[model samples]
Target: MARKEFQHYEAVSAAVPGDGAYSAAIAVKGLGAGGAPTFHRVLQDQTFKTALAADQAAVQELERLIDVTSEGELMFAQD
Candidate 1:
């Protein structure tokens, strides 16, 4: 897993085990907040062969995130 600090939030890469593969996802949470962190699944239409690959891909996608809204929304960089 990869973690990065973003203002008052901390974003981390996650690999969700599926039937035969892993799903790329990012988990974001407020640095000092109380509630559970929110999860944002990325590259939804794709699956990785390994958890490591999924985590790496999630990290890349996390890097592409421009911001995490106050309401826990993910803002992506436009192409």
Candidate 2:
């Protein structure tokens, strides 16, 4: 059995609504039928109180989806 190849994408957070909150976006990349790379949005407008907080939350979510620890360090999941 061959392991499927996967791409890693960084979660981005941007300011929105002119408030302290931020909107998060994650890109999904895949190989098209023509064997060309394609990119699309998997998530958008995920609100968070602050940009840094949003980015940290995004990283944790990504780690959960990818089943990998953040830099081999332990992170507790929030309730």
Across 1-79, the per-residue lDDT of candidate 2 in tens digits comes to 0112234322222233336566543323332323422222223546677756655554544444442133322222444
Clashes of each: 0, 0
The reply for model 1, stretches above 4 Å from the true place, is none
Candidate 2 wrongly placed segments (more than 4 Å): 1-20, 31-46, 67-79
Q: Which candidate leads the pack in lDDT?
A: 1
Cα-based RMSD of candidate 1 = 1.4
Clash pairs detected, candidate 2: none
Cα error of candidate 2 at position 17, Å:
7.0
Q: What is the Cα-based lDDT of residue 73 in candidate 2?
A: 24
Candidate 1 overall Cα lDDT vs. reference? 0.89
Candidate 1, 1-79: lDDT as tens digits:
8887778788889998988999999999999888878888899999999999999999999888888888878888997
Listed per candidate, the RMSD to the true structure in angstroms reads: 1.4, 10.5
lDDT of 1 at 27: 93
Could you tell me every candidate's TM-score relative to the true structure?
Answer: 0.87, 0.37
lDDT of each: 0.89, 0.37
- How many times do residue backbones clash in model 2? 0
